[model samples]
Target: MADIQALRGVRFNRRVAGPVGPLLAPPYDVAAEFTDGGEFGIRNIEASDLGAGSGNHALAARRYQAWLKNDVIRADPKPAIYIHRHRFLLQGVPVERTGIIARVRLADWSERVVLPHERTTTGPREERLHRLRAVEANLSPLYLLFRDPTGEIRDLMAAVDANPELDDHDQMGGAHRLTAASHVTIHDRLASLVAERTLFVADGHHRYEAALIHRDECRNTRTADRDSPSEFVLALLAAVEDPGVIVRPTHRLVTGGAANTPDAIMRMLRRWFDLRPADVTTLAVDTDLVGRVVLPRRLGTWDIFAQRGRPHLELLPLDRGPAWLSLGVTAIEGAVNRVFSADSEEVAQHLFPVVEEANAVRDVEAGRAAAAFLLPAPTLDRLLAVAEEGDLLPPKSTWFDPKAPAGLVISDLRL
Candidate 1:
C-alpha cells in the first residue's frame, strides 16, 4: 500500500526572486542549457553556473532562505494537498492539466509499491541529495501518474480548478511567457479517491530515490521525534491520460563507434533484423516512426542525418520476447552494447530525439553523424508494464513535457 498526504508547502517569495522566469530552470536530470554562466530559461528555475548544485543550487537555497526569512515564500498555515493547475501548449494545441501536488510517504522499493521507469546515475543523485540537504526542501516536484479511469479524479481536480484559492502567472521566459498555474487545496471530498490509486513515477525517479536515502541518513543523525521532512517525498499525482502531458521521442547519436555505416549495421543486424528501404523520408515529422536500428562497427566515421538537418535515428525492435528483446529499448541496448561498446550512460549522453527527421536526414547526407537512429514514442502503458514486470528501460527513454515548474511550490525537509 502507498501513503499520500497533504503537506504544508513553501511558495516563492515574489520580492526577492522578482519575476519567476529568471529563477526557473528545467529539472536537473534533463539536459538543461543555461544562459552564459549561470541561468536557464526552463520552468525549473535556478541561478548560478552549476545547475543542480553548482553555486546555482546554493543560490536557489539562499533565495529560498531569504523568502522564508522575509516572508517572501511563506508556508501554508495548514497541512493540505494543493490542486495544481498547469495550462500550456502541446504541439500547438492549448491544454490544461490538473493534479494534486502533495507529499507522498516514502515507500520502500523492495515493497514494489512505487516503481521507477528509468535508471539514475550516481553523480546526479549525489548532487541532488546534497542540494536537498542544503536547502532542506524540494525545489522541483516529481511527476507521478495513477490509474484514474473513472472521471472521479478529474472531477475532483475540476472542482478545485473551479474555485482556485491561489492563482499566479509563472512568467518564466522573457515577455513574461511561461506556463500559468493555479494551486488549490484538496479538501475532504477527493482524499479517498486519491488514496486508492497506485502511483507511477512519471518523472523524478532520482529525486524520489534520493529522498529514501536522505531519510535513512537523517534517521541516523537526528534525535528521536525529529519529524524530518525527508519522511515525505514531494510529488504530483495525475491521471495516466492528461491533456497537458506529452511524451517525446529520444534520438540517438552514434559517434566514435564501430556501428557507423548502414551496410555494416545492416549486416550485423541481419541475425534478427530484416532491412528494407525505410522510404520514410519524413521520419522526423512522423513522431511514430518505428524501425530496427543498426550501424556498422565503424559508426563514427560517417554522417547520419534525420529530417535532412542533423543525423536522426529511430530504433524499432525486430524480435519479441516476454523475457527480453520484446521491447525496442531492450533490442537497442543489446545492439549497442554487443555490436558497439556503447553502454546505457553512453546512449543517454549521445542520443537526441529527432526533432525534424527530414532536416536531420539532410545533415546525414551532408556528412554529420555516420548514421542516426530514430525511434517511436514510448507509451505510458509500455512504461508501466515494463516496470511492473520488474524491468528497467534504457535511460532517456521518454521525455515528458510541460515539466512541473520550479519555484511554484517548495517542500522543505526541515523539521
Candidate 2:
C-alpha cells in the first residue's frame, strides 16, 4: 500500500525574493540549458548551482542555507497537502492539469507499491544521490499517476476553497497556482483514496531511485527514525484519466553511424519495413504507421521548393507481434538497431532523443545528423499495462508536457 501524507512545504518569500517567476526553473536534467541574462536571474534553489564540478553540491547546500538565513525562503507553519494547478498551452490549445503535492513513503522495487515504467541510467542516479546528500532536501517533486475511475479524488481536490498562496506565471508562460489544504479530514480521505491503488511514475525515475538509496544509507548510519523525513519523497500525484495529463512523442536523431549514406540506410531499412514516399512539406506520418524517417536533403533547406522532391520514408513493419509493435518507441529502437547492426549501448551513443519535430528536421537538413526517426506518442493505457506487467520501456520514451516547476514547494529532510 502507498502512504501519502501532508508536508510542511518550504516556499519562497515573494516580499524578499522579489518575484516567483525568475526564481522557478525546470527540472535539473534540462536546467543546464536554461539561462537568464548569462546566469540564472537570481540565486534560485535548483537552477543556479548545477555545475559539473564536485564542489557544486556543496555550493548548492551553502546557497540553500543562505536563502533560509536571509528569509528569502521559509517553511510553512503547519503541514498541508499542496494543491497545484498548472495551466499551459499545448499546440496552441489551453490545458489545465491539477495534482496534489505531498510526501510519499519510499518503497523498494521488490515491494511493488510504486512502479516505474521507464529505464534509468546509473550516471544520473548517482549524480542525484550526491546532490541529495549535500542539500538534504527534495528540490523538485516527482510526477506520479494513479487510477481514479470513480472521480473521487477529483471531487475532493475541487472542494479545496482556500485562497491560493502563490499564483503566478513562469518564464515559459505557464500559469501555476498553489493552495495549501490543511484540513486533517481532507488529508485522511485523500490518503485513503490512494491507499488501495498502485502508484505509477510518470516522470523522475532517476530521482526516485536516488531517494531510495538515500533512505537506505540513512538507515545504515542509524540516523533515521520510524518517521524520518528521509523515508519519504515529495511528489505530485494525478489521476491517469485526467484529460490534461498529456504525453508527447520523443523523436530520435542519428548523429554518427556506420550507415552514413542515405542509400545505405534506406537499403537496410527496406529489409524490415515497407517504406512509402511522403510529402516533404507536410510530413505528418499516420499514427497507425510504425514510424517515419527524414533523411538529410542533398541541396537546399526543407522550406525551399527544390527540396520538395526529398524522400520522406514512411515505415510499416513487415512482421511483428501486436504486443511488441504497439509501443512506437520500442519499434523504432528495434529498427534502428537492426539497420545499424548495433546493440543498445551503441545506439545510445549515436542516437539522441528530441521532443520537437522541427529540431529533428533542422538537424538533418543542416548536415548535423544523418537521419531522424519520428515516432507516434504512446497511449496512457499501454504504458500503464507495461508497468503492471513488470516490463520497462526505453529511455526518454514519454515526454509529460507542462512539467511541474522546481522550487514551487521544497521538502526539507533535515529531521
Most accurate candidate by lDDT: 2
Q: In model 2, which range of ten residues has the least summed lDDT? A: 302-311
lDDT of 2 at 118: 82
- Residue 266 displacement (Å), model 2: 1.3
RMSD of each: 6.4, 5.0
User: What are the per-residue Cα lDDT tens digits for candidate 2 across 1-415?
Assistant: 9999998998888888767766676777766555651233333446534564678788888888888898887899989999988888887989888899999999998799999988888888888898899889999899999999999998889888358878887777788889999989989999999998999999899999999999999999966786899999999999998888998888888777656466666665565555666545543444446557888665222211111221122232334334434666776676567666777777677778999989998898888988887777778888888787777777888898766678888999973
Clashes of each: 62, 0
Model 1's TM-score against the true structure: 0.78
Query: What TM-score would every model get versus the actual structure?
Result: 0.78, 0.89
Ten contiguous residues with the weakest lDDT in model 1: 173-182
lDDT of 1 by residue, 1-415 (tens): 6666666777654554454445554566542554422222333333223445456666656655765787756776766777777666665566777777777878777777788777777766777787787778887788888887878888766655555554545443211222212233344445567667677888888788888898888788886242457788888777888766666656555554445455655544544443444444333333223343423344322221223321112232333324323444555555555455555566555444454445445555565655566666666777777777667666656677766665556787763
